[model samples]
Target: MTWKVLLPVGEATEVMDTLYPIFRLPEDGFEVVVAGPEPRLYHGVMHEIPPNENIPWDITREQPAYHVRATEAFRDIRPEEYAGLFLSGGRAPEYLRYDQDLLDITRHFFEAGKPVASVCHGVEIAAAAGCIQGRTMTTVAKCALDVTQFGGIYVDQPVVTDGNLVSARTWHDNTPFLKEFVRLLKASVAPK
Candidate 1:
């Protein structure tokens, strides 16, 4: 049987963070359904520290990237119907945390112990959902407070796995975190 994964996205969602799993999960037979505040096309952005030393910046630079189409709306999502959740990162989370519907959906995955993958600013959603408490995870250093502020432990690493939740600091750490997430998802469905 094919398992479905819910991915919440919004305007300015990071393209790299969102694309990797969307394409990779299908290789493992997981169908990814992008969920938005409303069902529609959302703009994505590229977040990175420019390679040129001419511009010294402390944080990532965001450039408009490809668009992501969210076929499902958060209000229309039934968390119980999906086997896992994948939270992508970007500036969107800075605002999306206020979404009540998305928060409710995020809480269900953690409460149910379903596999979840969060990267970069994605931590904001999980944090706002009240699901980060007591769990250790990683996200962009700037977002460490999202974990700690919500009563969770913050760690800096390529990947951090706490129970069914797997997280990474950024898309740069995607390989390790996604590997762990895929493993968790597969294990969750393994015959008991």
Candidate 2:
């Protein structure tokens, strides 16, 4: 049977963070189902530091990029149908965390011990859902507080895996993050 994974996203979602998994999961025989607060196309953005000969930006800059469509809405999601969850990062999580339905969906993954992957600000969603308490994880430095404030141990590493939860500091760490997450997903479905 093909396994389906849930990917939660919203406007301003980082392009690389959102698209990589959308395409990569299929290579492992997993279907990626994009979900959002509502069913529609969300505006994605690219984030990078501006290199200047005279002045350098202190943080990543955001620019409009692509539009990704959510195949399902958070309110309609049946979390049990998904074999895992991927929480991509961007400015989106700054607000996506406010949606009760999204938080509920996020909680189901951790509560059931399902495989979960999170990158960058994506940790905000899990933090808000109160799923990270006592879990050691990593995220973009700026979001480290989100992990600590929620009672999680914030590791400043490219990737950190705590049981079923695998996390990366940013999209740059996607390779390792997805690697570990896929392993967990496969193990979950392997017949004893």
TM-score of 1: 0.98
List candidate 2 stretches off by more than 4 Å: none
lDDT of 2 at 17: 97
TM-scores for all candidates: the values are 0.98, 0.98
Task: Give candidate 1 regions above 4 Å deviation.
Answer: none
For candidate 2, the TM-score is 0.98
lDDT (10s digit) by residue, model 2, range 72-172: 98999999999999999999999999999999999999999999999999999999999999999999998889999999999999889899999999888
lDDT string, candidate 1, 60-113, tens digits = 888999999999999999999999999999999988889999999999999999
Candidate 1 clashing pairs, residues 3+ apart or interchain? none
